[model samples]
Target: MHDFVRTPAAVVAALVLAVAAAATPAGAAPATPRWDHFGYDAENSSFNPHETVITPATVGRLKKKWSVELRSDQSCSSYGDPIVADGRVFISDYLGISAYATGNGAKLWSHDWVGSSNSPPSMAVADGVLVAGYTDCESMSDPNSGLIGLDVRTGKELWSGATAPLIIEIVIDKGVVVTAGSDIYNDTATVAVRVSDGKEAWRKEGRRIDVTSANGTVTGRDVNGTGTVAFDVTTGATRWTVTRNLSTGTASPAGDVFYGSSGDGDDLEAVSVRDGRVLWTAPDNDGVVAVDGTRVYCSDDNGIVALDSRTGKQLWRSDLPDHGALAATVAGGVVYTAGIALDATTGRVITGTPRLSFRSIVTGGVLYDSDNGTLTAYTVNG
Candidate 1:
């Protein structure tokens, strides 16, 4: 509509611009594989399907790619779980929130919440937005707690909302951000917030609240003997409620199923995500549960057991060297626990690397040992 330059120089510039645009594909600039939430996704699967490079044949040769100390002075400790997304790794610790380059562990950016309550922040990332729970340490008896959302690339604050007293865990799923915290009354509560904007969706009161989700539904167990409840992830409507003696306060979700332990802390049970119906039960289980889409892994004081996710049938059980001291992460056909990597199907220790630190996470063929602050990448050696 306006007057345009039609000279020879303008024509050459137009040709150069067109060539440059053709060189790059749409959304190709920053597209990368991301481990966006706790347990890799809303299901807390702890399983990575995109990780084809690290397999049973190659896990032994995994070498340390790089490591970054979140607390260089050892003044604070890293808490909660980290998330890998947008070509970066984000972590929240006692010191503050920080991000690193996923490939090399180079420090990208960091933010210090000056009044931190000496607790670690649990974080989740979605669509370049990082959400984390933190507490203000103005006093030991009464500290302010809240959740903050930041721009994943720049570490800029997007929005924040104050709630509860101690925000411990966070999960982002189905466009809903849920956070659990212990209120001032010593009871735990789960607060659901909309992801598009920092707004409260619903709040429920309980104790030892452990939250998990799958298929647009979220579940939690109020370890105060109130049992478990499932709710619609988007609307926060109660879908089902099951009253059982759930003392462990932990549950793992896989699709429409979840596994939990009883108040006696010995019997492990699986329940339906739809109507809270008990599907199957395995006795003498300690209820430390994790699902890898195909199998349900549970640990007790004596050992670890593998159950078929569909039928709750016992596949194999492995005795732990640490006597269940270390938690388990099931992925890539390997059950990593207590510094031992076991074949998931056979329950045989594949490698006693001893370097498999407690509370480590595997994503995109890399094992991140948060216990010692190290990141190791794996490859299949020919």
Candidate 2:
């Protein structure tokens, strides 16, 4: 009983387009690579596997594309590496946190805070949520620290909750936000909360547990700084614990090993994650350490050294112009440290790479460098 009417071509095309749009998933992965964590992910590997643009061949042509000024005052300085995700970049310091466009450095939205005295803020972003930590500068005697989650696209506040007295680290993984820092009583604590509702999942306190997560386990060094304990990230159940004479630094986790320094500062040791047994040790390295699939990178008083991940054999070493303590990030077959690029395999400095005052992060075909209060973006020139 339907009338036989011929539909217009334009009308038919519009109807087909609407149906296709509705079938797309709301939580699809981003089209471009993202540097979404403090060390790129919950493992704190400091290596971006998705990066493909700033390779050794193209790094020499990187030129500044845009720059933006951040809030600089007596209370705040740009604290750490810029976090990039969802087509925007986020930065946090002692004062507050802000977001900007990744392509042009345009200000998108910013949330500023007051009374953040000596405690600098920390931030982590995942699944379109940006979580930031704040301190109670008003009460220095018994200071209160907390975290706030925001909608990454619109800067909308989603949820906020209080945590330990000092939040030194924040990592988002498996839909949980894990924070590690000192508690009100000057004891180190690690707390986990759900990212969806900001509800407390579990808590571990009474030690200097510098925590990092991988798979479903959260591993951290114990109160003595020489022992490590692995816990179930969801229930805080102790999985394993081991004590050794290891140096007191944040352990960077790779697939099955935790890379750390020896107590005497003369060697780098790789400890197995399953049983906390020492795998191998490489000598003549100390300071910040980063790891990729095949090589482990470390910075010392001399310069940067690369060691085989499995056997702890030295591959190469490249000297920086001025080096004391430096941060290292690896991406696209290039090792970025102290604002310069070195070939990942050879440890040779890229000839024309610009030297930055602070450590820089490379992702999505751009180099993000922050100094004092200035944030600059560099792209490979034609």
Candidate 3:
């Protein structure tokens, strides 16, 4: 947070950098190749072309171009940032997903997927087509939810189908749409769907699919059952499949191919990208929480903790808050975890305090939660 009274100039400079950084990348494939997923690339790094860490000195300087009220809907919880491609912003109003005029925020078209969402669905655009994922009310525990494709220019629904029984998330790798889901009723099967038409191109025979892909290779495993499988994205050929008894944690980092799993107790092991090898393991991580490239932040009996991405060693741990869910990201040169501030290098809680959500895309940063009723726009000071 910034003191509204002092160093207004410093605040302004920070805002400038932030505005300069908010620019998202798009490409010619969908006329919006720039946007890939959550972190704006398979790596889930959340770093855009201009996303260098913005600091406290830089936070206050930003400005709000304009805020859209997004037709007041009691049902919508806008957790994901708006995606862009071509000349429009692709977003899901609490009502449904729509393509809005990038400059004026005018509604061009929309496609609604009736799913119970905690966060907005992510988008993948390729070949002038748009693809997205949603938690299906239709398929609760199963990811056999739904995948919808829209003609980027017109709001016309090109294709919509059940790619997976429960599609927890979707990824666009090398122009193909890779989704995760496991149908419990039909046995256990994970599948990869083509983004252009909601078709199941390749699916795990009878195994549950919990894989994450980058460029094209699949990296992940089935949780609550078999570990997961590492596969070549191009041929669906298995690189490695694990039967190790463990809880499937966060899908491996898409690009680095780094995968992780939670053991019988509170333990986490980081797997290798070159080969399906256990690189390192951290002690007793009860809840293997958020996973990113630089670090893997988890919840444990010790409270929120941080581990080195490559070594799986505990870099920092702080008993900021125990038992509460933790959210984290590697930004501002620190592992910003919920309840505690794990020093980026040391993982010690130099700063430990409570915060609301969305404050900085970290756990405590939630400026206004869904319960807050109709948040028009969020205003923050560095």
Candidate 4:
């Protein structure tokens, strides 16, 4: 395995270089890419199309820019994945939800829930509002689960609205915030609320965990069984239902295609989001699926596998172990898995890439990784 070791002298040198790069002439700098949603967007695609840096050629030069200690110990937990928006990064955990400056890791603002617990919460940001879903600490059997909207710039509570129960996922699209999860009574639901005022727009029961919105529709898994369903984002009207059990987890949507695993075997399947038709299945390749414009990426027993999006043909496979738990984040023609960077087309590891001990997201020419109570930022040229 290729790795980059950072000694004390190397760290200081990297810091100086990062400071110098940040002093570049103002107008000459490119626009920084923003990851505004948990999975990068409403479709949970986990791919950044606007990234102009951190490509395979430059990934090996990545250096630590900043880091923040989220907690002192590992007993606590981080709620949802960290999201970057409007020059800041937001993260929720057992302590509370906090925002930090993406450039220097400075704390901008934070909000503490009255009765926060270990139960995970989901969050998404849009239109200057950050929507977070949480379960009150009263009782799990009859918990007061709901969504709260906060000012993304100031972290002030704007409004709160009720929802089903444990919110497994949240997505925002079409001027609404959509949430999906079930309660202790086994009543699963998908709820949508206005992003401006936290008012219920529509609610559909029987549609269970994990919701993703894109292309005028919201898709989720079934409540009682292992199927998938789609509904109109504005009116909660059923668009289509696929009875086939695609996967036990969430599916990543790219354009009109939904990619997921079957959970029963090493097969990654692609289904049409319009009609739930099985487009193709790539056998012996399954685990967290990420789709870009032309390829589908997933983790299997052997490592990371890339498939042709249209025909499900295996394009390339990288041989690595213990990668099944890491999701692939594609940006600038490179696939990032935990700490490894690989050529998206050829599946070759980029030598000297920093080996991170946790999952990471690359945006704005920097990589942000959080694990074991620490969030760190890396960049090739600050």
Candidate 5:
């Protein structure tokens, strides 16, 4: 019998280790910070797919983790939603901008703007900079509004520019910052500025803009009744204009779908993101719509309706008592609206559902709720 040369145990072990190391993925490159925009993402999906810890089965045992009170006033509503990114929660109210640690709710830093006039500054973050629109409600005139860029880490003001008047709804994409004016007389005037140094890049009149899933494209609803128009984000040039119907509210863009109102005042319409083709319509008057790419959640008069994102088919519906849902957002396979939690697939309220605040969002496996003047975080359990 020929004697076989046996491999050394140490050598075999080393070979196995190398093969296992190669098979294992490099500790999945740290996930990117989420909740960067008011609608949760640039496409305004308001969906957090990475939130695996807080599931429908586990949300019933959610416990309050921490809470922090934000500054606000009676005159100005703190309607600007807080954004979470880079392990920090950034919120804006009349008192100014503040940052808190996502894990401990510890105050990181705060910055106040001079002559901000007690208005909720539209806040967003891009390229490591927190961009917000400061409105001088006391003046309400030219130069009364400006865009400010701040260092996200230290809450330091990096740049500011008086680009427009009464800036509202600050949306950032790429390097361009779009600021919609709250001018009662001119809802159509929109401006874009460079986020790096707060420089005006372009401007357009008579166009209220909405973001889309595509980059460099924004939907502009004509205030003069010309219809819903699409414009270039960089040059303010009109790409296409559909004059058949009046568009209303903030457009919810997901993939190729743009969901908004049709000015008929009773229904929400889904249009093509490419050419504004009517895809579907549903009954809705003042309900806020949030999409998760797979499903759309809306607070309608009938209650919370979950529709298939691709076909707009009603998947399920749940009725809430108050119907005063502040914001409807989806994450962790659950739908949260007006302090209630519902299963995304079945639309049934989960048991032991914690009464959240009027507005809340699930991020990093924690639910953050803004109630009265305090922001509270909750730990969910199954």
Candidate 6:
């Protein structure tokens, strides 16, 4: 062995090394924020615009782009998720909708209406038209529903119309305006109207609007509100609404429309409209996350699991010891279940589940209300 030699200064420096290490900054780049809102996009595309978000290691740290908070005292109670477009983000409170500057979360405009706690989410901005839904208290069991159209360039109401619906979902197809809602038997639940003047072009005699696809096809339920229906993009005619339920996870790929229940139970099914067939189902399932073309990532409120999207086969699972999942999202070849990550190919937990800044992960990012509501973006890297 070589002879040992140490200077007095060198010995002193070694004792101070621990202090320096803890102060080191996270040596990773920040991740791009993801816009994974439900019911897809303006045209109902489940495909997230930020499709590259695949892995935990690849996810960069992120800060809020902007946010608008509404207290129930102010008219809403964390009741719904906000919608994003071009550069503006739209938020809906128990009262109505607000348009905000996405770059800075500044309030640009606000709209309101009195609705129940179970009010469905609604919003759309396309070709200079902004639309939102409103409830009709005319009847209790089956009331009329409608949408308000506004000038997309400026938050101004352009036109208003009636759908005779209860719950509504709006989308654009091939440059045409479309919206749907639930109605009674022999009821016109799904209706497509011209965005320019809010004129009825096609109205399915009986159906309910649940979710939509980018291509304009819609997925919904039947009269009782638990079956399934896929209405035409252009004519509001019935494509097909199977009896199965749908999966409610992260937004799906663009134009992949389906329906399923999320309140509870082991069964959650979502079919694709591209071919009008049952795409996948989770029978022994707990809750689910995002599904890429290849694999379906899922978790119970306790652990993470993987399934083959095409065949509904089990891939693998990992322990999520303390927390439950929020939504499963995939980007950069890694799968995110709630907050943890599993290798896409091996179904192994590569990273432990992360603590959430907030429980409402759908609206965008979450902020700690303690530190003056410090908004923290839930991302892979930054």
Candidate 1, residue 263: Cα displacement in angstroms equals 4.5
Q: Write the per-residue lDDT of candidate 6 for residues 264-305, one digit (tens) a residue.
A: 556655556665575656676664455544555565557766
Candidate 3 on 1-382: residue-level lDDT in tens? Answer: 0000000001122443454444434431212223334443454443222223333332233333233455436663453445456766565556677666544556777666565554567665667777766664443454435567788899688887555555554556655666655455654455665666767677764544333454455555554456656676545677876666433334344455454455465567765555656777777666555555455667666476666676877766667554533444443433444533344445555432323332123211111112222222122334
Q: What would the TM-scores of all predictions be?
A: 0.81, 0.84, 0.67, 0.83, 0.84, 0.64
lDDT tens per residue, model 2, 36-109: 77666666677766555677888898899999888766652345458888889998655677899997999898
Q: Kindly report which residue stretches of model 1 are placed more than 4 angstroms away from their true locations once superposed.
A: 1-32, 73-81, 136-138, 186-189, 204-209, 220-227, 245-254, 352-354, 373-382
Candidate 4 residue-wise lDDT, 1-382, digit = tens: 0000000000112332353356455567654567776567666777766565677668889899999877332433344457788899888766778899998999999888776545546677778888777666666557666688899999999999866555656667777876767667776877778889999998877775344565656566666666677778778888987776664233444447766666466677777778878888878765544666667777776587777778989887788765452666777777777567777768887888876754577788888887766788999954
lDDT of 5: 0.65
Instruction: Compute the lDDT of residue 194 as modeled in candidate 1.
Output: 69
**In model 5, what is the error at residue 264, expressed in angstroms?**
1.8
lDDT of 5 by residue, 253-309 (tens): 434666776767677787776787888877653544577555667667748777776
The superposed Cα distance between candidate 5 and the true structure at residue 244, in angstroms, equals 1.8
What ranking of all candidate models by TM-score puts the best one first?
A: 5, 2, 4, 1, 3, 6
- State the lDDT at 87 in candidate 6: 57
Predict model 4's lDDT versus the native: 0.68
lDDT score of residue 359 within candidate 3: 19
C-alpha RMSD (angstroms) for model 3: 8.4
Q: Let me know the TM-score candidate 5 reaches against the reference structure.
A: 0.84
Model 4 residue 28 lDDT score: 71
Clashes of each: 0, 0, 38, 0, 2, 32
Better of 1 and 3 by lDDT: 1
Backbone clash tally for model 5? 2
The segments of candidate 2 whose C-alpha lies over 4 angstroms from its true place after superposition are 1-31, 74-79, 117-119, 136-142, 221-226, 245-254, 263-266
